[model samples]
Target: MNKEEANQTQAGKEQKAPKEMDANDLPKVTAFQDEATREYMVSTKEVEPGYYLLESKSKKIRMLFPEEGKYSDLLSNFSKNEEIIGFDEYDKEANILMNGQITYYQGQSFLRKTDTMIEIISGKNKYSEEYQKENKDNTEISIGYKKSNFDNLDRKNNYSYRYFGFVKPNQSLDEGVEYSFIFTCKDDNQSCSLDEKIARDKVKKMISSIQFSCNKEE
Candidate 1:
């Protein structure tokens, strides 16, 4: 090829080559910049009994309540190695709600608030072993919620939130186990009392409406 043509070809190749991006030139991209980009954001229809859905700027997660145990496993997973700051328990009949604090690397964090409800059905005293003899299983249900404040050194009070639901039984059943429904809501609002009340009311309505009977049995 001619020298001029060769030079032109080299220039074209250089122009087509990708430009190098320096650290300064890299675009600053934030995670989940758009809510629609989230992988698991819960929709109104996805919300159901015995489930907890949590969302953050970049992450969304859901926890489903199994059919018998309290919130012990749920709390364990959530607060693994974290410090406990506040804890309170309230018992009414066969139900219980426990609220507490969990601390992680980011200083004192709030549990937002937690509620655990347990119901015992078809269980007997250890001495009698009646539930086992009667071929019945012990059923328990629980729900937990946690709200964490965002770790912002510049901002005074920014926060994020999480929720958990669980259920377990003494014995696995051939039929699907019954689960207690639980739901939680978190926002920038500082009034825990109002938020707690609303969350409780909503969850209660959900639980009350659930039908555990099988279609065949019906």
Candidate 2:
């Protein structure tokens, strides 16, 4: 080709290069950084013994016992002090709490004794007498325990322990929302009825007073 034609051809190729380039070859551009964006990250601050502030996404939740040692120790002690009767396993498949054969439906929280009784705590509206009646007809009688403070009482049997049953709300539990429940049962002969009642009352009072704080940024 002639020199002049070759030069023109090269210029045309260069002009088209910009349009033909892939997205990765484009000049780097960035959205301007803002002070507000930095605020989205969570911040840590000590609130008190066994509590720390966690700030994130313009919101804050007081993380109880941020330090592993302190937090774990508190949990251990609490378990020991509260004579935990039993734990309800989380049934992911059923989306409910399971204790042996008894399956408390979702939204219905309870603390109960094996073959004794179950104490329905929150979400009572979801619980129906008909459901209980139908379920009770089975050979296994799922006894429901009432709210009690069996945790602080002296250990009388291998089975006696404090327990809290919770059924998380359909909506997410807000950061500041607090929950509390209890479980207690009488001996086989119902001999500890009076003592159990007193202990349960004390626990109910203590749990009712638990307060939660929510601090989310505007």
Candidate 3:
């Protein structure tokens, strides 16, 4: 081929190289690093007394939180990974919660436990009876997942999310224990330019690398 023609062909190939790349070949999303923080690479955190590590081995994340409720013996926990037990809690005064429980219907993994006795007349139950009634008949589903949704139950100024589900059945997590991951704004005003949606995406992206384990911790 002529030199000029060969050069043109090589340029064409270079242009098509990027377009020819498969979407599946792209790297997995890691949004956690978009903003810098000392807390990245969670696997390196030092454990303090009375706290345990909830590490995502695949993701290399390790979070340390109190093993039991502060100064309380009413330990509500989930039997995770045979030997690893974890629990969820909420500080009513602070309007903050960590990994709370949610129940689901059959084939479904999350359901708001029915309060058949609590009459909604006084407005304690925001869910209309018809809404409750519709779901009440839903058979308790087996293993499944529900997309995590950001929530501010206490109407705290901070933004956060809760998720719950059973990766497996038979061993039901306790009523109060939450099966979710959560993130709270460190500052009330959230001084950053990133909007709430972007923040949530970052959190989800960070979790994408994590894989839940059911076996005992070594």
- Maximum-lDDT candidate: 3
* True-vs-predicted CA distance for residue 46, candidate 1, Å: 18
TM-score of 3: 0.25
* Cα lDDT tens digits for candidate 1, 132-190: 11111232333344455555545433432323332232232222222222222222233
Sorted by lDDT (best first), the order is: 3, 1, 2
Question: Which residue runs of candidate 2 sit more than 4 Å off their true CA positions?
Answer: 1-158, 167-172, 176-194, 215-218
How far out, in Å, is residue 116 in model 1?
16
For TM-score, candidate 2 versus 3, the one ahead is: 3
> What digit string (tens of lDDT, one per residue) describes model 3 on residues 81-185?
222222344444444444422211222222223232122221332323232111111122211122333465553343454322222221222111112344343
Error of 2 at 69 (Å): 18
Among all windows of ten consecutive residues in candidate 3, which has the lowest summed lDDT? Answer: 132-141
Judged by TM-score relative to the true structure, which candidate is superior, 1 or 2?
A: 1
- Candidate 1 Cα misplacement greater than 4 A, ranges: 1-139, 153-157, 168-194, 213-217
Score every model by TM-score. Answer: 0.25, 0.22, 0.25
